[model samples]
Target: MRMYYPYVNAYRQNTPNDHNGSNQVMTVLGNGSVSVQPDVANVELGVITENVSLLEAQQANATTMNQVIEALLRFGVPRENIQTTSYTVNPRYDFVDGEQIFKGYQVSNMITVEITAIDQIGSILDAAVESGANQVNSIQFTVQNSDTYEQQALQEALANAYDKANAIATSMQVNLNPIPFRIEERTDTMPIPFSKLALSAEAGATPIEPGQIVIRATLEVKFRY
Candidate 1:
């Protein structure tokens, strides 16, 4: 049987001129999407410190980062979920009379923390800041059970393709087959992180909103009718 993919010419262009079974074949593409609320979050926070010496700069950075990690642990974040992502120490220079002069040294240490609790995101960020986090970098929210959503979308896409095939078979006055040869195309959805959140005495908790996550599925179905 010949298949009629939308992007490919099944009868007029590719098949032989004497091909007579083209009327029995039908191809369809279906797209499906579902919206799901995020269940987990990953937040990156860090501390930046500057000192006259590299040792002092690194020491200060480590001290602040340790305090931040302790605070997160106290807030119920697991030790395994917290990881050091970046650490750097650089020399600060001052240009005077076109000469490079060393002024001080600056150190930066960053860690990524995974938060499973959906509702405590804001309060946790606030707590980290209180524990000496000065450079708040990024916060990302996503669904923990992505497999479930993707399966649901695939089912929906299959159903949509079947419906379209049925419609085409009916219009062509042919008997539709029960099963079709289907090719599934998978698409992954990315989480759009919330805008920057800064700490302030007046702002009670770091306001955060985890928007909906969308998953999509596509299928190419070929039916013999």
Candidate 2:
């Protein structure tokens, strides 16, 4: 006996074409970014180590670091600007005659200092060294409020996008500004959290250079004209 099947509506049909349709609406979404190496600034500081007995080493490092902090404070570095990056005690090893022995205890302390005065980077380093900072670990120059600069960049990017759109519109003999159906702002900083670059101030005066910051934005414009 023959069996009868229920009629399937074209709308409800689960055919391949219906389920996975691919007649894409040709829409152009271009992305552009503006980057400015804004003035680079950061905590120009260091870590000092004095290896003796662990206790003495700790005391010495503490004293020196305190002096450094004081000098920085005198140089106008605010209390809140100082960040204690690290502190630790490690055993120093001495190898002799094919034998390894404990030489002494090394005490190390690190503090991050944010110096806003770009002009005094050299003076600050000299002061830190004079104040007893020995082991210079890391010195980094970074933007204090990158967000503000980044926003400026974003605005520039939007303007760039507008420029591109207008150019395209002019080429097509149409005005995009009023003919666009909609203009949506697509903004971002690429990486959410920006990491500051680290440099060593052990050699030269803390290199405080104002470079540029990178920022970007995109706009999806439907220009009917």
**Which candidate tops lDDT?**
1
Query: Candidate 2's residue-wise lDDT over 1-225, tens digit each?
Result: 111212212112222432233332222343556665434345535555656578788888888888889998899889998888777788888899989988888776777776678678667867787787765544454555566755565456445545666677578764333223344556654322224433343555645444444456665644333
Off by over 4 Å in 1: 1-26, 96-99, 167-178
TM-score of each: 0.79, 0.61
Q: What is the lDDT of candidate 2?
A: 0.58
Our model 1 lands, by Cα RMSD against the true structure, at 6.7
- Write candidate 1's Cα lDDT for 8-34 as tens digits: 222212323433454466778867888
Error of 2 at 177 (Å): 11
lDDT of the candidates, in the order given: 0.77, 0.58
TM-score of model 2 vs. true structure = 0.61
